[model samples]
Target: MKVLLKGTSLLLLILAGTVMGCKSPENASNFPKRPNILFAIADDQSFPHAGAYGFAEIKTPAFDKVAKDGVLFNNAFVAAPQCSPSRAAILTGKNIWQLEEAGTHASSFPKKLNVFTDMLEDAGYQLGYTGKAWGPGNWKIAGWDRNPVGPAYNEKELTTVPSTGINKRDYFGNFSHFLEKRATGKPFFFWYGGHEPHRVYEPGSGAKAGKRFKNVQLPGFLPDDSVTRNDVIDYAFEIEYFDAHLLKMLKLLEEKGELANTVVVVTADNGMPFPYAKANLQEYGTHVPLAISWPDQIKSSKKVDDLVSMIDLAPTFLEIAGIKSAPVMTGQSIVPVLFSKGGENTSKRNYVLTGRERHTHARPDNLGYPARAIRTKEYLYVKNYKPERWPVGDPVPPNDENNKRAQTEGFKTLFPGYHDIDGSPSKTFMMKHQHEESVNRLFKNAFEKRPEAQLFDIQNDPECLYDLSGNTEYSDICADLRNKLDQELTKQGDPRMFGSDIFDSYPRYSPMRNFQGFNARGQYNPAYAD
Candidate 1:
């Protein structure tokens, strides 16, 4: 009798592991003993961008090879659209809402929540990380000795980079150093977090590198112009740069005779850093690419269409290690789907839940654009708690008073207006051409206010160009989805259901600026203090 644990205690999880009938992964013999786990995460990349997904603009040979050798997931999503919360969810195997401070961007991680890394370490797996890990937030305040992912291995540095914005962390070199330092004969779990395709990309780098303007595909929400095309192409260039390092790392593993035994999971933290994509609860925001290769266990040439979440990764890792997941985890392991010899959609999940709290210091008083969503194969339903607020951010620039205060307080980055939307060439173009008739709608779609309830038929409108929530024809579908979302959120104890402002109460550890008394002029008001 397989028992599905939900909202159970840690004691129960431990007891179940030792119990005769309830032994963890009752069929543990199916998996090879102690396979190495190689988790490679790109910073801000969306779905269908990699070569495996048939997007020619971005070339990711390593990701494509992993997909060809193992499973290519068509419907993989992050727990939150923002990086911090999304990474927190991936580490904890729980929804962002379940984590208090960690649910918001640049907030301190609570010490009570245990990460899978510690569990894996306890299980005698050698652990380490290179490049970016579970942060942009401070882990020290929570008394963590190191990053939640594990000890760092970022001493290696690259002498030169293709672009000005790309990090010179020497990711592959650092991974080689990590392998050299690890204990002999022990299975390793490594995190290769690549900070690429995020923002501040080199201008015309893609076109200069022989990428054509005609090949670039713009999303429906963005303007179809030279600026947008150039910006997207530049983003693709960075992704390829990240992939090059991944290819080198894979080769290193293969040379060491560990590629076949290593469970290589390649994915992104969130979507592309474009307006209506990164921080928003839209399709491109939460949806990301995923490819996992484990030649010793998983079957090759399989494309899985089942819905999977970043939160599910932790439990999946634990299950593969023959250890039970922590009871606090709300996410179910995808081991069944990973090891399945069946058709594409073998998993039982009908939908995936995604939400966001604070992303950047975009709104006044560090308040986040609170929203939750339920995504199914055909439709996506979103419930925005604060519909009156700007979805992207305040259109107005920061007041001189706030700017001066930030400088006086010694903050690194200035309060750039609309901070939630990453500062990029595309964003600059939209702001400059907001008055043009063709660009006006696109700007509004990205920068303006949104409705409380939004429903999109993803099958037909994958770009989410139309909302069916107000359409009388889809009233029943909308109602049913809303009820389902509400029920699940309530079960998961989402505080927003009862009109609680708990997410806002969490202390933001990052830089902050105040925008007071501007909402009357169609901007932010200083109602809540940061």
Candidate 2:
């Protein structure tokens, strides 16, 4: 009886040890088991707008929290100033120039190119996206039956609202649904693309909501007036709205007990939609805000000043998911900077590059004005391949008699009417001063016919107000940047850098030409002549 009792006691002790071993904390810092990824992208947002980035007028509590908890990169940029190309680069981890079809705006993406989402899904992770995804273009050719992100929502689900009269589809409700449907014990990837702060802002919305124009700081390139101030305020309102949705999404994640394990990255597709900002390769055009948070992994808040591009995002996402990247991906993973115990490295890239193809339907034969640029920490060198073409589409007089009459009567109107059209006070101011000597000088300074090469000192002139390309003092800087750009172009396999003879060898893809209005009948409208 004593021997039997002792054996029973030993069995109980072994069972207790096994139970305790199962309860031990999972060492998630190692490989194989990956954390979930949540990438939230905003449309047409600029740098320094969120409170985390130092914008006092706008309240972005969620973004600020992410920055406060993790890492905020001060020098993050996009490969292209436009949406399609930038998004393509982020997904494929390839340079825009290398993704020929995907390189152009509204162009059809080829099926041959592999996306990070596909790799992640293949690696046993559930992948989906809510709201805007790869494009305003067709993804069918890319073998996607539905949106690359996922399936669309029902009509009733789509028509709901967060606040009274405000669309809920534009917020986190859809994102919440996406998270709920994700399978248990499996990781998920979601892309929350918010279509806020793009354009056609509600007039007086900011002032009505108690936002004061007096607190607004005018950019040097824009005219300082009530009209411009009000325009800026409207922009602020939309940015705040976007932030509100982000806050709700964060709450949802927390409630699900997944906040600690999930990696959240917040950023924008490109710069603002203002003139000379969006669709241009300037600092204000390509520079964007980036904030990342991972409570279970990243323990402290920090700021990194390395020159990181949107293209790096794909590789970083793949690295975090423990997926191997393809050799074609030119972008390097930023995981080392985020997860390393040592201090973050800011000496990664010596320069960043961007370019623009087509913007609006302004040129004849649906031609686009091509320009490429290289931006260093202190200097920006641009090469305008086509100088004679109008940087902004060619001017087209108002077709409607009432619109023409309004312009004649001194009311404001944006010309060409192809891209943006609004009767604003700034438009009136621009019209009044369109031909004045001082205004002409400013216009020349901002946008004018340029030589093949242009350079600017960004430190002294943040708005790119002056061109120091001709200045002898900075001649060495220009030569150095030019040589660096040439080397990079060669490395990237761009035919343009090789010679004009090889330009024809590279396949040509039209940038948003069909969507902008290139007639399929091949007929020309002489009335729209420049």
Per-residue lDDT tens digits of candidate 2, residues 1-530?
Answer: 00111243334423322111211111122444588888888887888788987788888998998988888988888888777778888888766666654665665565656777877888878887766687755577557776655555322245543333234464477777777677888998888777777666677777877889989866676666677788887788878887888899898889988888888999988887765577777777888989989888899988887778888887777777776533346676777678654345643787788876655444444555567789877888988777886665555455745346545655334253334212344444654676876455555543455667789888798777777888899889888988888777666655345332111112223222222233222222232221
TM-score of each: 0.91, 0.83
What is the C-alpha RMSD, rounded to one decimal, of candidate 2? 14.9
| lDDT score of residue 139 within candidate 1 | 88
What TM-score does prediction 2 earn?
0.83
Q: Could you say which candidate leads in lDDT?
A: 1
Task: Please report the TM-score between candidate 1 and the true structure.
Answer: 0.91
The most accurate candidate by TM-score is: 1
lDDT of 1 by residue, 133-242 (tens): 99888888788989999999999999998878799999999999999998899999999999998777889888887888778777888899888898889899999998
* Local distance difference test, candidate 2: 0.67
Taken over the whole model, the C-alpha lDDT of each candidate is 0.82, 0.67
- List the lowest-lDDT window of 10 residues for candidate 2: 18-27
For model 2, what is the alpha-carbon lDDT of residue 289? 88
